[model samples]
Target: MTAPIFPLSAVVGMDDLRLALVLNAVSPAIGGVLVRGEKGTAKSTAVRALAAVLPAVEVVSGCRFSCDPADIDPDCPDGPHDFAGPRESRPARLVELPVGASEDRLVGALDIERALAEGVKAYEPGLLAAAHRGLLYVDEVNLLGDHLVDLLLDAAALGMSYVEREGVSIRHRSRFLLVGTMNPEEGELRPQLLDRFGLTVEVAAPREVDARAEVVRRRLSFDADPTSFAAGFSAAESELASRILTARELLAQVALPDAVLRQIASVCASFEVDGLRADIVIARTAVAHTAWEGRSVVDGDDVRMAARLALPHRRRRNPFDAPGLDEEQLDNALDDHSNDDDPHDDGPGGAPAPQDSPAPADSSSPTDSGSAPERPMPAPGESFAAPTDTFRTRRLEVPGVGSGAAGRRSRAKTDVGRVTGSSRPTGKAGRLHLVSTMIAAAPQQKARGRTSAGLILRRQDLRLARREGRESNLVLFVVDASGSMAARSRMGAVKGAVLSLLLDAYQRRDKVGLVTFRGDSAELALPPTSSVDTAAARLTVLRTGGRTPLAAGLLRAREVLRVERLRDPRRRALMVVVTDGRATRRGGGDLEDAYRTAALLAAEGTAAVVVDCESGPVRLGLAGKLAMALGGPAVRLEELAADTLAASVRTFTGAA
Candidate 1:
């Protein structure tokens, strides 16, 4: 028997999340809600409980596709239903889409043999069909394959699934309430996917002792005896459900006034979100909010409430950014939107905005609050400097292919992505190349005296599809914070470069570690982990000073990678060293020691990059020499930018 779900009414805190869920339920036209929070935050619990408060759906009895009795879908696979057939009422289902789900499992598939041989179309319904007219929940949504996510978003946007495979085509209504829950620390979803979500909210565990205690109390009680625990909250659940039903009925009658319409436009414009989707979502959510409040019209308050839920994901620029709107920023946008129109959208004929300002920070955390502290003067080997404005760095990928976690860098052998070719199964292949297997078996079939039933397939004839996809690497950053370069701008630029790389790692699903060498010693500032946010935090407060220990840094990086490889042998490592180059003499670590260490790394075939932080017209090209030893590329600071990268980035056989 399935365990009873914890009641939505029993959830202790998360007012924003609860409200967002209710609003989406009230108006699925709001698109869908993406809930982002840390683990143990009840994100999943709240989503599952949503089914309890949802009104039961009535469908044509015996219809496999869950077709509505009154509005039967003509295109439904199980169609041609009798209008006079018995009807059945059932609670809305909550179908789950697993992270590892394949395209065939999502949009349905065809029986290949029947379609190819018998010239018959046999369609097997997938999760999209199962979720029709119900709720579809995806857990660990960020970890889901990019292609699967695209398919999901496409179906959700179109409100239908068109599955055509092996000459068999099937189409059906797939409208549902898409509720996805993700822990930001695991990884980030693509920007394209983020924008598709109608509303986004960030939740954290309740800070209040009493609220936390209540959460534990209720959870324990439910675990002890789910039946009795759920029964106790039955009345409250029903009342909430009834309210939702009433809200749904009243939603069509709610008025969205011109003032509110303009307000929605103004808020989206002020936030400067890309595309018109945000505006539309805000408008829809505003109407839902009005109904939830038992009100007739969307007022200014309702508009703000809608923006609060709808604008977060739209404005996000990076993975580490906390997913929510700053109350002050939102108010300022709404209060001054009349004149605040795009800070850059001005001048006669919409003249180009001024281009002289230093670029916005790529390293700074958007969510960090409180004023920074004053930095004390550096002693022998340490200095404090704010990060320089980060730029769009060049793509620093590990050369060749690898078998690792799915990512956007370095070629990988994966199940997803386009089929590159076919290869015989080495051990257990990723995906089977049906056509290739048939081709390999065709000639042998006649030799084996095949009958008319079908071509006999032998175990040795199996062919697995070879696919080339990108895999995330373990990015180990070796930063030089020695006294040789301690100026704020110099160190800041170097710090900014590291910060920029960290952002890339976060987006590419790479685990990262930081190693800083100064004052005759190298220290592991941060260990390799999926949480890039933590690495960013450590970088923001990083202090630099002391003699440069270039050799020590390389040695430490090798050690870190060695340990990481043991834990996860499949994941590859890419070492990124940030420095002006050349080990300091009259004493720091020996330049020869550094070179030898670099050579060792190169011998190991470790993909590496040497970011030459050297500034000014006059230079020794010491960093280039170091890059040569590492057998990677030597990219200068100016050359690291997206615009200048292609022209100036040089591949170093051994040059730093």
Candidate 2:
């Protein structure tokens, strides 16, 4: 027997999540709920419980699409056929979306047999069709592929799927409650997709000992005897189901007061929400909450609850920003709209409105002894002759097929590469290569008795096309932070330049690593990462002092780049060495050693750029010579402003 799902009521804590799910059920017009939390947080448990409590839906008999009898479309074949067929009521289901599901599986495909034998296109509905009028649950939603997420969004937004494949053009209703559960630690959902979810609830593991113990006890009891444990909650489940039915019935009667509407708008505005979706979601949720409570008119409490569900995920502007609403600000906004007659209508419990506290005056004055004296600004640094068109990215070639994942270069079709997939797959093999399939099936076409019409093919004769993708760049910054460079504040200038390059790296989807050389040798400051925050943090506390180990730094960078290349051969490697080429170590042969190491890097196909930080009347131009040895360009320290430096590197690297 299948294991019984934990009852919704049995879920410990996480009142917000329960309410959000309930609100969506009562008013699916509220879209769907997204539960974000770690494992053992009852996220999945609550989602599955929703299926148990959901009332039966009337669907057309024998309709694989689960066609709703009441929503018959005249143009749809199911309309006339299902209308004459028997209609039956079945309990609404929670359809789990598999992670590896393909686009054809999610959306429907052409009937293979009908097309192959009769040469007639017949539509075969997919999982989305079965999910109609039900809850489509996706676990670990953050880990889902980008293409699948886009499809989900489109289906949810349109409430239908329009398929035009294999000479078949059909549209079918695909309305479903899209409930997704994900752990934040695993990965983050795209911002665009996150906003599509009407309600976003964050759950946490039970903190209190009593609650934790209760959860463990209940889980153990259920595991020990699921039948008996589920039997105990049967009556409660029935009552909850009845309650949900009543809430659905009352949903049409739920009213939204003008004040509540205004409050929703105000709260969303205060939070700087991206679009009006939050406002609409909040309003619908408030209506749902009022209906769930068996109330006709919506109140401040309903609005507050709605805001809690709808605004959290939308408030996030950056990747690291936590998903949550500004409660204090929301309360203040709601309080401002409270009725003049009702003075205590601040929130649910007649609490007073939150007010911003006055800012404290500055304690220190310019004349204070404790405060340091301000100095006059120095004159601007001399500007260099910057190239008009300096920024361009090189399109590097590699020996591999592309998976279309981010950071992989998209290129034209080529025969010499790994067999990735066809540019377009729309035949017997699903993604069968048309040219190859036709040629393979040519011999069998005459015996198949379809020669008079045209060339015919069998499934076995199909062949898939392959994609050839180029390599992406990986720029590694090797900075000279020795005592000499630090004394001249060259490190500061280099830091700014590196930051600029990092920004460029982010845009181009290039990977970056930082290696700062000081003291006895060089150390990896920051490992290769796409995160700008990580790079910034590592660079912030980088200290500089001691003799310059130019040769060691070169060797260290070469090893790092070599290892990285081996790990991801699809990445074109580049090293930007920031130094004056002055090797002031005790041995005094470090310059030659560094030049030899640079030549090894060049031989390894690693691009290089040496930024000369030397400042004197008679410059040795050792950095320029080092650049030549590395087979890359040499840039002067004077041309080391963020933009100029970035542009010079881009130009040298041939990056557009």
Candidate 3:
């Protein structure tokens, strides 16, 4: 493998993101940080860099689970008694969950040979087992299959997986830090899964020209000499690792005062955030911030810093709402609660601050004393102060779309059909057919047929049938290879998602096509071909930069379908458009014309699914409108994974 490049010290401009990583490093209980950003936003680079700086954890030698021999609990099967000698130790592991991994490969399965040969049930370990006490990173997490995601969440929450398959009843501890990265353009992760994340930070491409240039320069240098480049940053990497270790040690002593608790609650209330997630995350993050700063006590500044990372994704009343704790409103609330002589006050250190003393400007104030100040007391009637705003805007209900019930029903139906077909074999069974056996036996009997021995089919003669469904699916991927997409890092994510989908299609023996539109033209890079490798190779070479010519791309895709339709009507055809919905050109005109053209093409017998790849606060624009016009689904790009593609294919074709 290539040596890891891009040390953690090289990351710049994303202080909030870095803080989230630091917090998670200090306390894994704080949960994983969700970094939402466009494509070129250094999200993966930062993550890899952080991984390099992480302290190497000691794990059991020869154990795929990376079990801590010293920390082994009663549930551990391979206890000290089972080992021949003292267990060995090794460095921490960073395991990547590839998109195409199977269920058996992920959660483990029965040892088939052991079961069949010796009639002994033996358990085999999987990726989860291998990732124990390490980092289990999943890129494009939102697009992961719902089943796989559920399994991951269950394992992460319970810290174990119980396997009760093939007469084996095995429960193994499989605890690991779940680090997931996604580009929001593909699709959104389910809310239940999203809640599991402790901190969320939105990453954007380098805004300054100098930063972008520097990124390119560094990347090129590393590519030219991976070993030397990594060696150059060794000192910086060591320093980061040391800092993280210090933070982890300091996390336990970081104290949260009642004042900070009140601030956290007030901020959540001000934002009208639903549930207790915001409050909980804010508190944990605050503690982590204090620990990171080498402080023994959490202060107002710690709470303030935590708010930025914890509050954004938690206040989900409006999914599209801008993130952060509403700094202006939060500052005002703090000012209002800063009064002295309040009986309810408990500022930093638990005890009441002197009523006559001025408030500290920073968390580290009273430096000469070398100790945190006493918690302040709340004034009379101040403890029960009502919020200025009782209610903010309710969560936006996208018209005509039922929130949970309808969606669940649709998804359930889709899953049922997909599972049934996926489980069935496509070719002939190995044994003799039942009908053939009956016919062969009939010929051996006399004309009377009943005079002979009663007809009996032996187990050796029994044959199981296989169900074969329509083989090919015409999948046309309409990619928005526009400049804006390239700027936000959406292009890389889109490419990844497309590659994942193509891999799925290839496995299913489906045909796929690639059509990318940018600048003044749309190009059909690859026709509908069963060779997914060829299509994927062409896709990887696709660079994003130009105006969006969505109309032309759709028209070309439609024409390709027109030809394919003549060959087979049973074969499913789908047009997947990946874009941020910003259809514009270099001539300084709105993309309204292109949008209309796309809509018209989509209406012409093409089953369409639009993936909004845009990130940040930008409006989704014409994508949603066009999806509606096409009478198809509009999903965020981050949500577009292998399962999503399969579900879309089934939905559009009404196929089993």
**Candidate No. with top lDDT:** 1
Q: How many clashes show up per model?
A: 16, 11, 27
Report the C-alpha lDDT of model 2 over 140-165, residue by residue, as the tens digit: 88766555677888889999877765
Task: Please report, as a residue range, the 10-residue window in candidate 2 with the lowest summed lDDT.
Answer: 382-391
Of 1 and 3, which scores higher on lDDT? 1
TM-score of 2: 0.75
Q: What local lDDT does model 1 show for residue 438?
A: 70
Q: Best candidate, TM-score-wise?
A: 1
Q: What's the TM-score of each model vs. the native?
A: 0.87, 0.75, 0.58
Please provide, for model 1 over 393-508, each residue's C-alpha lDDT reduced to its tens digit, 9 standing for 90 to 100. Answer: 55566666787988877677888765789999998747777667777877886789976756577888888877777788899999888877777788877777777888878767
Off by over 4 Å in 3: 80-85, 116-119, 318-325, 340-425, 428-656
- Which digits, one per residue and each the tens of the lDDT, describe model 3 over residues 1-656? 75676777767678878878867877777778887877878888887666776777766666556667667645654544343435775555677887656556678776655543443556778888877777778887765655566688888778898766435576788876667788765445566777788888888877799988888888888889878888888888788889888988888788888877876786676665678877888898888888888888887788778877777676543222223445676675555555544637666788744333232222111111112222334333211111011111111111121112111212222211112222222363332233334444455446444453355334333333322212235678888777767753456566666665655454333567898887778888988775555665566556666667666666677777888778765455667788777766556444666566666765565667788777877575567776776667777766565466456545654645
For candidate 2, give the lDDT: 0.71
Q: After superposition, how far is residue 624 of candidate 2 from its true place, in Å?
A: 7.5
- For model 1, the stretches where C-alpha displacement exceeds 4 angstroms are 60-64, 69-88, 112-120, 164-168, 320-322, 332-383, 424-431, 435-461, 585-589, 643-656
Looking at candidate 2, what is the lDDT of residue 544?
66
